[model samples]
Target: MKILLTAINSKFVHSNLAVRYLKAFTKDMDYDCKIREFSINDREEKILEEIIKESPNVVAFSTYIWNIEMIKRLSNLIKLVDENIEILYGGPEVSYDSQNILRELNGDYIIEGEGEKTYREFVEYKLQERSLEDIRGLYYKKDNNIFFNGKRPLMNMNEVVFPYEEDENLDNKIVYYESSRGCPFNCSYCLSSTIHGVRFLDIERVKKELSYFIKKEVRLVKFVDRTFNCNHKFTMAIWEFLINQDTKTQFHFEISADLLKDAELELLRKAPKDRFQFEVGVQTTNDEVLNRINRFVNFSDIKEKVDELLKLRNIKQHLDLIAGLPGEDYNSFKRSFNDVYSIKPEEIQLGFLKLLRGASIREEAVAYGMKFSPYPPYEILKTKDLSYEELLKLKKVEEMVDKYYNSQKFNNIINYLVKQFDNPFDFYYELGKYFDKKGYFNRNIGNSEYYKVFLDFNMEILKGDKDILNELLRFDYLNFNKKRGIPDFIGRSIKRGEEEEIKNMLRHKYSFKEYYLESFEIDIQTFLKDSIIIKKKDYYLFGYGGDIIHITEEIKEY
Candidate 1:
């Protein structure tokens, strides 16, 4: 049988690890199996054309909340093109409601839970044209009736095959791997809570698989483990192995900050800069709200550990906050935002709660007066404690935070401007409101235009010094931008004559070759053309001469 496994990713940079696992596990089977990937952004007609060219007898799709709707449309289209082609659905999106989904969509089968073993067996039955009644974890339609083969028991982690093989090319793509399955905590809003216990792959097997990635020098490998640090020894072994390797591949993990102990901190401190990124889910600071969602977290402990991690100055910390929870009102969520923002991690993700399928929170949503969209992603519209209008307002705040804080382009200006408000949340909220009033949300704002818009907003609201703000804004602009021309709002301080005189003085102090090689690491002509100087308390020099920026200061009289 000709088999085609398809994955429609949310973005081009993402890979579907589930499909890869299915392919690897069924590698030894006697069938022609191939993989095809497309992003959700791809046109429906274009995707339909490509799948038709493949001409496979069976097409299996790996579904997720972000792409399930697209998959549904494509599946029906594929059937229209050739009704003989079989449609199969798998992954978290269809796993929970398998039988109903098979009946609703134009799919012949659905694989629930862990798919590797079950998929292999199902394929064997199909290749032999035998009974699929014995295949567990499979939902199939026969004689116009949908039949589920019952739930499959979890398989040993060691039995799973490595997703990435030697022949695959992973350049410019994020490789997703899981060292373990199931989460230790029962956060009711998350799908991970549906599973009971944690299961880990053998440590040696994990090391061997990771070694392959390191040898290939993959740019990024993201661990999908819900709480990576739940088992201290297992986590440390992988970290230590990566730290000792002589490769530049970066690893990302989602870990719980409150679970960090001294030993873990000591090991993380040794991690190389830019080598690791952490996602810590501090959903809310209110202990009562956490309890309502069956999430047990100590805000104080999380803050303390986060501070220690910040002190390490190596790993990039991305903290998260969920807005619409059972007991969190609009005002209460603002407090939670302020509490998390005060920690000042590298990034803050302001997310609304998602009422996902199979999560306990979805079942309890109506009890708390939670109203969510009845579709894929099922984002919360409001709860008993929050109104739809209030949630919409927070959406604006989320936009501003993403543009200013998370982008890190307006770092200097944001750091200075946020202090002027009562708290960080107020700062972002006011900025968002200003942007909305100016109708900036409707227009396409360019990268350079952000500085001007922010400047106007600051002056209008804070009535602060334009000169000081200009200097900081210019400093931020020069650090990120390479173009020599400054925005009209951020006019240069020094006259052309003084700037030339300073460049001449530098030439006399050090030869152009030596200075460019040691400091800027670019041609002297490019350095002279691109570099800009802003007069703060001192002459702060900034240049984006290479892949990295080098900022220097000249205190001497020019």
Candidate 2:
């Protein structure tokens, strides 16, 4: 019999680790098995045609919240083509309530949790004509009645086979690796909280697998571990190994900043710059809100640790904040935003709350007056403390944050502008309001247009000393883009004589060969037109495509 394990990812760059694991574990099985992956962006008809062409005896889908709806439709279409083919579903989205999913989706089988061992057993039983009544973690239908055989126990991490050692091609895809399974902390809003205890792979085995990835020099290896640094020793071991390797591969981890020990911090301090990126979930800074959600964290301590990490300047830090949470009104969330913003993280991801299927937040949602969409993702619309109108305002704030702050385009100007307001939140809130009024959020604007909007807003706010704002805007605009002409709103053109002088200076002092100017792909004439010259008592400098060139030294002063 032929078997096919498939997944519909949210993006094409994402690879399905679940199907790879299943394929690796059943490598020695008699049946022919293969893994096929597709993105939600693919056309439904194309996906259905591809599955029909495979003509497999069994088709198992790895389900997730992002792709559940798409999978249901695709599976129904597959059944229409060939009713004899068996259909199966697995993954966290369907694992919690297998019976309901089985009844609603009308699938032949559902593997609840820990699918490797149980799926191998089910395949064997089906191909060999053995009874599957005793198979744990298998949910099936018999005589139009659904039956669930209960969940399987979590497997020892060491028993799982390495999935990537045999694969050759991983171009333009993020390779996922997991040194451990399960999460130790119980954060109510997260699905990982439902699972208790942590299981780790043998250190030697993990090293061997990592060695394969390092040897291949994969572009990125993202750890899927729920909390990568839960075990200090395990984290240190992997970090030490990766740090010493001679490769360009970068690794990413989701860690708890407050839990980092002194040794781990010191080790990270010595690691190479840009080699690692850490994602810390700050969620919220409000203590009352944190308590209500049963999330254990010391906001002050997190800030201190994050500040230290920022000082290192080697690792990229991504701090996250959830906009809608229990007891977190707009005012309280503003405080959370300001607090996290002060840390100067490389990226501050402002996200909203999602009521996951099995998460505790969904279970207690009614008490907090949480209303959400009845579809996948189940994003919160409003709550008792925050109205739909208030949430709409925050949504605008999120858009502006993504455009200005997260884009890292106007870094220096944003820092300067925030100081003019009472706080960072006030600046973002006012900017969000302006963006909404002007309908900027409804349209897609380019980088240069964004700078124009910033300049206009600053002109209104500063009222006086417009030159300083213009100078700062010029600096920021040039710094972000390398091959773009200056926007007209920034300044007027240089005088005819000054323009001629600038052209002579560029040819005589900063020749194309001497300064490697050819690398910028800009001609001297275009550079002269776009350049902003700054004349000082001792030196004459100009900004062109983020470069500050001093031309006075080459000229003889009278």
lDDT score, residue 429, model 1?
A: 85
Residue-by-residue lDDT tens digits, candidate 1, 124-207: 987985479989999999999999878999988888899887979899999999999999999999989889899999998999
Give the Cα-based TM-score of candidate 1 against the true structure.
Answer: 0.94
Best by TM-score: 1
lDDT of 1: 0.84
TM-score of each: 0.94, 0.90
Alpha-carbon deviation at 402 in model 1, angstroms: 0.8
What tens digits encode model 2's per-residue C-alpha lDDT throughout 470-532?
656665565555534556776533455754565566675454433312111112222234443
Name the regions of candidate 2 deviating beyond 4 angstroms. 165-167, 459-466, 484-487, 490-558
lDDT of 1 at 183: 94
